[model samples]
Target: MAGKVQKIKDWKGSEQKGTLKLQEAEVPRAALTDAISEDILCDLAELFKVFGDSTRIKILYDLFSGEKNVTEICRDLEMNQSAVSHQLKILRTAKLVQGRREGKSIVYALADEHVKMIIAMGIEHTEE
Candidate 1:
């Protein structure tokens, strides 16, 4: 039952001769469906999927410093131009990063604060 307390076995080495003590715990329920819609969930899943790529993560981390052209990104990451551009395209489609024309190159950067915050949170969580 949602939000109901129930007694369950502790599974620790506290068992008695012929009986076991039960611990009171709350059973988890689906809490997200009430707060998020299916479409939003799908979009969130897609957003995370985009983050699943290592190349994209590197590009985002590079952008965290400041805007840089694809050539700069390629040099910083030691990757080729086309590979970096492809990852940038995915990041752009996910709205995690953006680019602008500077001279003859497109200088890329994180789209907004939320992106930087997301990556920062991920770093913090991993360290924890």
Candidate 2:
């Protein structure tokens, strides 16, 4: 498969670490030095932490195409209800999955464009 795909590598704290907007600033070089507050890295690390689990990855994979209830995910992935539920709880807390009450069941879907794009880019990387 060959096509256009958006890709973002894990931030490799290079010399050019911050975004380009900061890079283009007309301020002095010393002022241009990125003095990152410790919390910024911590928050970014937490973002990756959400993607660091196999179970969570599977939950995202199962729902990649569209929303699905617990039963649908369990049945499609051949997982037990407890197993799917546990993974889903983690995804929900990460804000990676959104749940809505639909009759007796809740449907879960990817929470944002960024999550979907990252997953798509990951797929593309492996495919490449």
Candidate 3:
């Protein structure tokens, strides 16, 4: 049933009698497939995957403030050079951030204003 409410049981104990609880029971919402476009779903999955990693999240946070070279980012995070470089590469590939060569180093920053907003929104959501 698409909208039929039901309850199963909790891990702690058996199901309480006479309680019609809508638990994790898989009640398929037929409208969901219609509600979300494929493109939107793909984009959301990509965004979540990008944000899933602690290293990438930190990299985004570092770039959120302003442009910084790999060395600067490494120092701030107290991470190794190669580790920071790897995360930066992933962020760049995702187009969440971009970098330009400055002297001997490539300075990275948020590719678009949306990036900062995305990070801010994430922080706000998780903090709450």
Measured by lDDT, the strongest candidate is: 1
* Total residue pair clashes for candidate 1: 0
Off by over 4 Å in 2: 1-36, 126-128
RMSD per candidate (Å) reads 14.4, 11.5, 13.6
Better of 1 and 3 by TM-score: 1
lDDT of 3 by residue, 21-66 (tens): 2223342445333488899889989878988999988887766557
**Deviation from native of the Cα of residue 58 in model 2, angstroms:** 1.6
Q: Report the Cα lDDT for candidate 3.
A: 0.72
Count of backbone clashes, every candidate in sequence: 0, 0, 0
Clashing pairs in 1: none
Best by TM-score: 1
Error of 3 at 72 (Å): 0.2
lDDT of each: 0.75, 0.70, 0.72
Please identify which of the two predictions, 1 or 2, would achieve the higher TM-score against the true structure: 1
Give candidate 1 misplaced runs (Cα > 4 Å): 1-34
- For 1-128, candidate 2 gives per-residue lDDT tens digits of 12233232431112331211111112344433558678977976887888888777878876766789999998888889999999888888878899999999999998875575566556656778
Q: Give residue 117's error in model 1 in angstroms.
A: 0.7
Better of 1 and 3 by lDDT: 1
